[model samples]
Target: MKKLLLIVTNIDMYASGKLRTGLWLSELTHIYHSVKEKGWNITIASPKGGAVPIDPESLKPLVLDKISKEYYENPVFMDELNHSKSLEEVKNDSFDCIYLAGGHGTMYDFPDDTNLQYIISKQYESNKMVAAICHVVGGLLNAKLSNGEYLIKGKSMTGFNWFEETIARRKKEVPFNLEAAIKERGADYSKSFIPMTSYVVADKNFITGQNPFSSKEMAKIVIRELEKV
Candidate 1:
């Protein structure tokens, strides 16, 4: 059976300048359901071993909507979130694809996660799909292939943009600008005209979503890539 490894960054309360957990329930729900619907296996992992916290804002009905409400009500979904495996605990070759879910927390931790980067580069070089949404793009910026090139070099990808970061006051939240870091990695980055609109770009095996709104769309495209594989 094919597997989708969902990599979520852990919250860094002090480093994040507040609690910054992976925007998990919305994304984990979408990717898990979508992959399971396609008859694919999914596994959840994070930078830390367990106790994956969610953003307070995302847990609200106003932002989460009906589907999210239904997801929270599911025992299976809640259990997965509760028992999320740590990235240090994964056996990378067991999965066929990897998906990085994002939040402001990712900006703090994902970029510097060398072990996660190693896993991602290993999987990608072996021809597995690597997908991410929002600030999760931080992981991609550091993954280097055996040839020593940045995986995203020359790839057209999108993420939380510079302008949106400004609008979101994320500069006060994170140590660096996500857009600048992505641009430094050599991607041809672009984004939607409005806040929180769904946008994704597929450049070879690298698929990226612009924000939380892009989670389901990114998962669907990731399935497409896995099928092609």
Candidate 2:
């Protein structure tokens, strides 16, 4: 079985700490369920070990989908979030793929987590898959390879865009614009013409999803890429 490291944020608040934010429930569940269906062994990890907070906004009636809702209601599944391993714990571990799940809280910690950067660097340099979606793509912004090159540099990818940030009313709360940050790092970033639509970009072993709605498709793409290996 191919092992997958599903990294999520531990920060439960925005940088200002005035607003609540954490992992976007659907982003993790959508990807988790899809990959689990393929029988991949998965581990949920974060910058700090322990419970990962769920974004309250993601649990809204209109936003929560059946799959995510199913996991949310399952005590067994929810327990995984309550006790995720810290990235440091898994720094020496190897995985076939490392997926970064997103939320507003990622804006605060993902880019600065050195252990995360090290994992991505080692994974990418070793020719393993490195994937991320939405705001968590921030994790890729600073990850550099052994050659000291940005992982997303010269790669075609997608992530939560500025327009979507505004649409979600998080333009002011987010620490940085995900799309702009990726471009600043030399990634060829693009998004769906209509916001919140499923848009995924696969550049070699690196796959990225544009938003939460893209998680299912992105997960499928990740599986497809894995099959090739």
- TM-score of every prediction relative to native: 0.91, 0.98
How many Å off is the CA of 214 in candidate 1?
1.0
Clashes of each: 0, 0
Q: After best superposition, candidate 2 residue 161: deviation in angstroms? A: 0.5
In candidate 2, what are the lDDT values of residues 1-229, reduced to their tens digit?
8899999998898877788999999989987998789888999999998989999999999989999999999999889888999999999999999999998888888898999999999999899999999999998999997778888899999999999988999888887778888999998888899999999999998899999999789888998899989
Query: Each candidate: what lDDT?
Result: 0.79, 0.91
lDDT over C-alpha atoms for residue 222 of model 1: 80
Model 2, residue 205: C-alpha shift (Å): 0.2
lDDT, candidate 1, 1-229, per-residue tens? 6888888766745374564545546766677777888987878888886767677667876678567778788887877877889888895457888888877777767887987889888887877678888888887888898999998888899998877778666667676788888899888988988877899998777788998788778878888777876
| Residue 5 lDDT, candidate 1, scale 0-100 | 89
Report the number of the highest-TM-score candidate. 2
RMSD of every candidate to native, in Å, equals 1.8, 0.9
Error of model 1, residue 142, in angstroms:
1.4
